[model samples]
Target: MRPSSALVLAFAASTLAQDQIPLVDKVKGWFAQATAAVTSAVPAAASSPVASGRAKVAETIQHPLTLENWKETLTVDPSASTPTTQEWLVYITGGNATCFGFCGNATKAWNASLPFLAAKPNAPKFAVIDCDAEPLLCNSWSVGPPSLYYFQIPKPLADQSAPAATVRYQPLNRTSTTVDTFKKLVLDNDFEKVEPYEGYFHPFNGELQQYGLALPLAYVMWGFSKMPSWLPMILISFMSRTFM
Candidate 1:
């Protein structure tokens, strides 16, 4: 008797599954906390700034951002962007709930900084949500930095360079003086150009987007909600087969 092809196929599939792990589940779990982590960061960032009026716009744009106002001030044209009311917020933060008090550093900085950038006259196509005390997330999108997730309306952000082009990964942090790294992501296309938002969640809305997100978040949320069902299933199936 000869071994059946089905048996060999089954054996190969079994091996493949054993060789890998279910990634969709992993992806879901991997960043499950990401949304919560970002949400938690919001209050901390907003607490001080909303209390202070200088979150956006320097007391004087005539000068560059000074050390005194670095944490709570920025210098950009207020007329740069049009004003619109939004509820949902996406945040590009360092890490999780604990990241804010511990691993987090730029959380507060972003909160204070974003408002000003968003309020700018013709302020690009996106609004700056906040800078964080933890600067890691918005600096690079590799390790240690928070994961950048896209949501409803992808905000228009430039790259971390001068004369920024529209990007979907990393959005520009006007407060970051890195220079040459100005990011520009499109509001419609998702991650069509660059790497994950600077480093953290939606740098524009500030998170993976949630039920409450409006403007950028709302837009980002729409995108996520619209994710092709077949794709996720296919991805899940392939991952299941590969990683089992």
Candidate 2:
């Protein structure tokens, strides 16, 4: 039988609503499943042993000493550690807390020969400061972990009031990290060659400069003097005649 127009329109609207409702339910169900899957995975990941092991490792790693703990000695601030007026051979070392092999080697090498070097009549003062323990001091020295430096703090003159300047010793070409090599470097190079010194200058430089100035003149005079003594008088007469 042919349906009435109004009834047919109503029936079409109801069918459309029913089709849209199922689509909406399907989308909601898919989202719920995805959320459940993610929520279930989170706790499983948190309970992982690998994550726990990494935490344990991070805890086990030892950090370096703080600046406050920095002392003036290897074990103590020795009573006989008198301040000196000479230059200093400062060993800025680090990585001991972590048991770094390089630091171990360098410290061992320095320890072996330091006593002998300290006993010399005019030898420089020696001090060992951990790099990590005193970062600011080490950074001021412009050195890195496990390195040696020569430092000098010249006393202010009797007439001056300002602080004395810090002098850093430059190794001209020395690179070996051994005790004997260090001693040789200390022996071979004069500390005065470096700048920022007080009442200390390279004495030979002036003489060398004077010699440099006189060398050419001496050479010319020598060549002239080698000629006969009569040559100059003859040349003078010839010049006088030509100019007359």
Candidate 3:
């Protein structure tokens, strides 16, 4: 074969080997990548938005629910003759802290939505329960603060002794944590029925997209450069026989 043809064949063989021949190298690369991924993931998992948001919410709320009025505020009497179809639109706030001593995002959303939400044919009662002040009450239900829970009473009745059964409004990873979303949650009366909002790009894909094609092509070129000259000839010959 001509020098140019031989070089071309050799390059082609090297490219094939770079992808398949170095088994040990491939394994080591995989293991290293997996280890790095796990190591890098630890901190991110620990400090997720939900985790940090809850902490921040806790810090903001200075005045929480007190034991004195807790029972009276959350009570629902279903056994009475004129029993009302009661539902509690409770905001399990981190604290009494609003963004500017008024109301936070969730609170503001509720404030704007209140007119519409209350106008519903059979609207539920609305109240905010400070998790910071009522940790025991909040913890009993395994709730993370700065969340919303809907309570259907009357039928459930007020069992001051035990915690109320509530439906958590856990929208798609906090996407549906808005007042409009909560209003929908209340109107639908089922959190599960609500579809997760996909308005934003997926976080995993966003990170990958930021990398682009340069990094992958660079790795492929690096692998090709590291290939042994003879390795390509062997691969090419093997391919020729396998095909013929």
Candidate 4:
């Protein structure tokens, strides 16, 4: 039989072990990002329909987590999860080249790139975040000059603290950049830190939507709030333990 992927990776790891690879260091970039996302989104969570927004918010955001400090701490059960590694790349324009924050144009650009991604059957899913005015600039969304931020939306819950990749990049053209070009630039960086490799199965997707979380079907749980937190926790714990 062919060598197991783990065995092959183990050999690679052993061979490269002496290289002093700063895996998580390269990926920990999202630490600040995690803090920002958590802090900024807290408001939205607070105003959520739930009372203990802190708990629900923490838990849900916890579910769709990011990888900002993966090496320092990795607690998610990796064996049970399918791997969908992720990334987030941001390019800025306008305002003296100083990046204020998320950009809408980049978001649009990413939207344009998705159809093309249909070809990468095994690649992590993708999404774009407009950084023109969120973490770096204003606290709210606004229209601004084009900038690009690419992400690998890993299989939803790929990691406990779901940090995506910001593919390593340098300036490439001013007006337009293609997704393929972006992918080509970042995937093979020797210096790029990237050791936080964990995996998980994504439960929420189109199929689930059609069956459960779908509109009318989801409404069936409209009164779900009435359910005891203990019950849900018990279920989630059981479900999580069952798979992991």
- State the displacement of the C-alpha of residue 158, model 1, in Å, after optimal TM-score superposition: 29
Candidate 2 vs. true structure, TM-score: 0.38
Tens digits of per-residue lDDT for model 4, 1-244: 3344444443344334322324453244335456566788456543334434433432332222122232222232345365645443333343211222222233334434444443344433332222222222211111123543233444336345454432322333433555554455444332144432222211122343335333343232322323543454455556557555
Q: Candidates 1 and 2: which is better by TM-score?
A: 2
Candidate that would win on lDDT: 3
lDDT of 1 by residue, 2-38 (tens): 3444444544444453224355533644475666667
> Which predicted model would earn the best TM-score?
3
Clashes of 2: 0
Clashing pairs in 2: none
Whole-model lDDT for model 3 versus the true structure? 0.49
Using alpha carbons, what is the TM-score of model 1? 0.24
| Whole-model Cα lDDT of every candidate shown, in order | 0.34, 0.45, 0.49, 0.35
| Candidate 1 displacement at residue 144 in angstroms | 8.3
Q: Candidate 2's residue-wise lDDT over 203-229, tens digit each?
A: 112232235543343334334434554
Better of 1 and 3 by lDDT: 3
Tens-digit lDDT track for model 3 on 9-111? 7568557644542566446545655676677756644546654565455334322344345446555654544334456666665432111112245644554
| TM-score against native, each model | 0.24, 0.38, 0.40, 0.27
lDDT of 1: 0.34
Model 3 lDDT at residue 98: 11
Which structure is stronger by TM-score: 1 or 4?
4
